[model samples]
Target chain A: MASSYSIILAILAAAAAGLVGAFALMKRTILAGDVMSHIAIPGLGLALLFAWDPLVGGGLTLFLGILIIWQLQKKTELSAEAAIGVIFASSVALGALLIHSDEALVDALFGGFKNLTPAEFAFGAGASILIIVALWLLRNKLIISLFSPELAISSGINVDRINLWYLLLFGLAILANLRFLGALLVGSLIIIPAAVSRQLTHSLGTFLTTSVIVSVLSMLIGTFIAMHYNLDTGATVVVTAAAFFVLSLFKKKR
Target chain B: MQPALTVLNIEVSFDGKNVLEDVSMELGAGESLAVIGPNGAGKTVFLRALLGMIPYRGTITWAPKTRIGYVPQKIDADRHLPVNFKNLFAAKASILKLPAADIEEVIEIVGLNNNIITTSVGHLSGGEFQRGLIAFALLGKPSVLIFDEPTASIDVAGEEQIYDLIHRLQDAQGITTIVVSHDLSFVYQYATKVLCLNRAGVCFGEPDIALTPEALEKLYGPHKYFHYFNDSHSDDHRTKNHDIQQ
Candidate 1:
């Protein structure tokens, strides 16, 4: 069950990381994604206490965080980053207070994928697959919105509605990846793969393809390494992604 | 014929700082209107208000079933964005449901090489990039086209070529064009009507009469030079030049 869950997670993580990651990176919402995941830590702690699926808690909390950030920024003139900063500070302070137990803290931060039940596995698989398909189907409009929002509006795309929908899906994708990448590093898993792929290709198709391939390969390799050496799963996976980013930064001869 | 677009009592304020105030204009079908202003004179604000992109207290009435094609002041894109003409064309085809023949016609009209469709947008030269963007806007098959600083990056010869192409396109297709530019020379050559936009609407009328020294002084705070068509012919001939006096 454990290995099967890891396999499912690795596959879904690849697709979600590549697809959602591209949107996150392009929209300049990488920081917001990272900060939202961090804000989910306390939710995970509460979920553990209640013996609930931690992803549920994390997803709910992340959604709430998005609303708080959006409203605060909308009602006031606070920049999105500044709004996220304020919420993030309060979130971390609350997370630190709630996550008193060491095991819960480790699980929240490092993500233990070794004990996922069949039900949890199915939930993760379902959510991740849904996100992947949604992204694939919405690529054209999403690309338009990301590239030139004014064009999107002029072309009759509801830019605001699309933005809100994308944000909600981002929260869900982060939740789905929380099994292995953990709340602390899930956003990085998404960002690193897409960032590396961006440096490699000049065509959108090639960029997306490279992102997915690199992410899948990294997840599988990191899983193997963690299993063999008894290392931290989340940290090892993120390190593998970072390695890909480093490799992509090398200049090829013109 | 009734004007294709009408703006009444238009005003835009950002954080209580007035960007545009009590501005109004009427654009007729098949007419080319140039919006000329100095930098920071709310020309962009005026354009965005027309596009319905910003909040403004105004009534912008468009003729029934008027489809507008918009080209923004600047395309906010990163140097590394993975965009090729083919991809952009494909996206346009999907969104606008344009036929292949119509799309190819637009590509030809914009004077872009058919073979350049495979090249990435970032790699295209400044002139080529402008042509490509114009091609993209043409895909909408709009009755009206709005351009913001379309010649900002092009060289002098490239600018002439673009304005010539625009004039030819307008003549061929009878599309209403609203252009925002600081190039008084090009605007004078191409514009049938002109509006000098400042915080408050400075002046609006035919190009020859609207671009008078008084309006120029008010909009630009005493310009060095300006040229207009000689009053004898009432035609677009850039032969006459004059200096603004205090």
Candidate 2:
């Protein structure tokens, strides 16, 4: 059995990753986050290729993903959605090719959840706290930017700077959650909670608060279920979060 | 005191077709200017250009430090989207960081009660939505307010209320107001200046001097049915005046 400290550490890591994902979804930039998550795959392959840690590889991969997406969005005629789609498809293909040639595909796909060292836990927890605090301080500006960027500009809010910060924080969150949730499900964790919360509240503050609560609860419950049933933790967490989303929809309908 | 706004050598074209050319006009502050012309006379384009929503090649400058507010001819907001007055007001204030009380003050000035604050904009009658737009524009306490055919989709009663609201806002705030309208009778009652436009701006002055029959004939030509109707109405009044004098 995993130590009590380890379980707590895992829950904390999941919550942090979930919160970052939630923030991205709230801002309606989930496509960007999804692209960054996929780009981490090639990084995982390269990390395994060099006998380096996958988390480090994943972080570097996610950073490159962000750079490609940002540059394409600014420079290309393609809309933000199309840019993300192109990057996402290409990154996934490249990652698949790298995995086929260098590392066992199962290892990359299942991720390194069983090998969560105490050091990685600490790193994830620290990164998550930093991202959450940054989002909190800029919540007001972020909401305004999301709703109407032109109005935000006239009001003296530097929208470009805020979008840059959001991208940076999103990259870091995807990087931190790579080991615990794998790169594939990390995007879902970010999107599902916030989307569920959106149906429950109209106020921005309420939506964010409820998103955090739902994320934390899903992590804890999913972790417990995984432990009892001896199931894969990452899959179990996402499934549980999905369950919560479905529950929110029903409750909202009532 | 040099007219509130000056538009000189303004030219706007869409896809190589000229919408307006060499359109020029000057309006004074605390004065009401009514722009009247047939359809496709670039009335909406002129208003949008003033708001900086479209790109135009010419010099159009307002009086120094003039805060300008605009109400579009129509807001094509999606009916499916659940937008309400509070949501709309909050969306704007979410940028300015203005307190709730400030939003409420503008809503009250527009004569919209608390019911409008919570009701969905999709469900509001055209009159209510127009008032909401006016309230949204006025929330900034602009020095100049421009309305582009605000009463186009509303009933006569709604138009009267809108006109009254416009006058009320002008009187209360001393704002320089410009309205683009086809309602000549309404303009006669409220406007201090008139700007007549076609593919090019034709005249800009007091309505009595600017809206001469000759000028109307030149701008509208065969489309002077409404102008003649107004002329006959005025002739009847003149005849009655002569009879009274006798």
Candidate 3:
């Protein structure tokens, strides 16, 4: 019964992470998250190598990802998307090379859902709550900056400052959830829920709210199904989210 | 009295090529100015430079630190962008951090009905979209308003309505206005000053004094439209009378 409870806790953690990811996707720029996830892998490998928690390594990875993107945006001709792509591909290759000899690869790639504890569940919930609060506080500036940056600037909004905060929040969200979803599928988690919700509603507020709800529900369903059927938790969760996206698309078409 | 805006020796270039060369103009508070030019004459570029959207090589000083509102030529709304009037209003409210009531006031002033505010901005007719943009611009109670061919996509009646709105806003708020347009007939009534621009800084001011037959011939250069210049003089006379009554 305790094992079953742990499984439930793991699903909740995954869902909270998924919700953060969804917010990133709704902003229409999740390439940055992708880069952070890749950079996180090497950090994870190094953490395991040094006998440290992988989440600590993931946090360092997320920070590096944001810093690198910010530096490239300032000094290079390459856009944020291009910079993220370069970082994402290179970091993934580096992580594969670094973790080749360790057993960490199995745990990192498939995720060890069995190892989730109540403390981790609390951490995940706390991170999710923090992300949501930050987004709420900056919602107006973020939405305006997204739609028409020039208009926002003209209206006396400091556009550069807003953009900096936006990138920072994006990095933190990816850092908080890198363990459950893995680097490969973290971006999909953020993008799929928002995209699916967008298909369901025309209102931006409704779309955002529905995305969060969908993310949590999918996590619960996916985790339960994974345990019952002896399936991989990460893959099951992603597949469940994808299935919901497909369903929403078909419903819109009708 | 201080002029609402003063542009002194403003020069604009794109990719090492000059678009607006050494242009200077001023508009007094409550005055209307029309920036008239042919296609590819850099009118839009000039307007953008004044708005400080583009980097330029001169000083644009405004009296009393006026809030300048802008309406761009085209607002592209793709399916990916779920922009409605509420989204636009929310964007303004967010940027300005204004109360909801202020946003509604601006919406009402722009004459947008409740039904239009709820509809998607992408699905709006040309006239409706233009009005929505005007509403958006007027939200902060701007003292200087710039419209970049607001009537270009709309019907004739729509164009007249837009001009009427412009006149009403100017009269009500005493705001300085600059309109960039190729359509001379629409602007003839409202423009206190007309600026005719071509490459190499060819311009004339004071609509009646500047739009001469010879000047029109020189600017247009062997076009069929030169004959229309003669008719424009008589139309200008009628327009002057219309402006007096308004």
Candidate 4:
């Protein structure tokens, strides 16, 4: 029953991450996920330090990380990826310094699902639904902004404001998924499923729907196999997502 | 009646270096103006200043609430992104807050076939892609249309056809047209007035009076001017293309 609760949380987190992942993949910011995931490790360390829930700790820490990256990118001459790289390296060192024990490091990297509670499961469901609905409402504007910034400006859309909001949504999805997927595997959860969907679909609508379906399936299969074989669930989910991406590559697109 | 657009002593500097200086012109309603110059001639900077995409020290006064449509020379699209004609048009239509028209109507306005809207933007032929851009510009229904090197990356025949289409569209709508072009042949054939620009306004008048051998020499310098003029260099097809028809 406890494992089932954790599984549900995993599914919700995967769904949220994979949905936004579709757009990020198109924007060529797929590596930003890897960067964010590594940086959120320090957030996990802070959660243990404060005796609060890891989700709260990680989300707040990653939020600060996002802000730093955004401001540095704007105020300095550094590129966006370069700004993220600086934060990622600093956070990794900080996370290492803060972690007390081998078990704590393992939990930070791979999430101790055994520690999850019923309340955490509920929180996962609510946050996932909220993120998905928000993305749905903003879909049209996001699509337009992603296509052409000049067209966005000419049509009266404030492109900069939309991009900031997009970054917020991206950071939120990444932090929320860091629980079950862990800081290491969460980035793959977002990228691989969306990438597989990209190869199979022609239109934007199909692209989004297919990515969600693939995310859910990968989580279900990976969790079941890992539970049965007594393997690391986080690693299994990532491997499962990779398997899907491989199958997708074989399927001819265009 | 007051002119459609008036400029007085336009100056643009980047990092304290002058890119364009003391440019002035007055364009009447429905008049077509072509801005011609060689590389580093500040043609794009001038166009950007006119579009209000950049800043300059100048008084650029337009008639009140004048709507303008701009078609860029080209857009580089990523093949990984999902961009089609209908969605692209829908984005602009939503911005305009106008009801979306049938694909056929838009294609007809821009002289394209109905089936092309579903194709990815990167896959379209050069001419068809340019028409697609013009169709998007028309979504705003502006009184003035600006083209930035419309015939670039197109074959000679394709360039001629595109210019011909522009002429027909301008006349039919009585649209005020402004084109930035390097093709002197097209300027001679279609421009009502020309502005020869190189860091400053070299000359501004009807093509016949402004584009004389002296002005050509001044724009291109003596060595390059000899090939363009003096009837010695037969290899210049644009000039030969002009001669063959005359």
**TM-score: which candidate is best?**
1
Screening candidate 4 with a backbone cut-off below 3 angstroms (N, C-alpha, C), the clashing residue pairs are none
Maximum-DockQ candidate: 1
Indicate whether candidate 2 or candidate 3 has the larger DockQ: 3
Compared with the true structure, the alpha-carbon lDDT of candidate 4 equals 0.76
User: Model 1 chain B, TM?
Assistant: 0.89
Docking class of 1: medium
- Window of ten residues with lowest summed lDDT in model 1 chain B: B237-246
lDDT of 1 by residue, B47-158 (tens): 8888888999979998888988887755666656677666776787787777778778878998887667777666666667777778878887888888887766666667
Q: Global lDDT for candidate 3?
A: 0.69
Interface RMSD score of candidate 2: 5.0
Please provide, for model 2 over A55-114, each residue's C-alpha lDDT reduced to its tens digit, 9 standing for 90 to 100. Answer: 788788787777776666554355767767887888778778777643355556544356
Clash pairs detected, candidate 2: A21-A190, B4-B27
What TM-score, over all chains together, does every model reach?
0.91, 0.74, 0.84, 0.87
Model 4 chain B weakest 10-residue run by lDDT: B237-246
Which regions in candidate 3 have their CA more than 4 angstroms from the true location?
Answer: A1-27, A31-36, A49-52, A67-84, A114-123, B94-99, B197-200, B212-246
DockQ per candidate, 2 decimals: 0.56, 0.13, 0.32, 0.32
True contacts kept of each: 0.58, 0.06, 0.28, 0.14
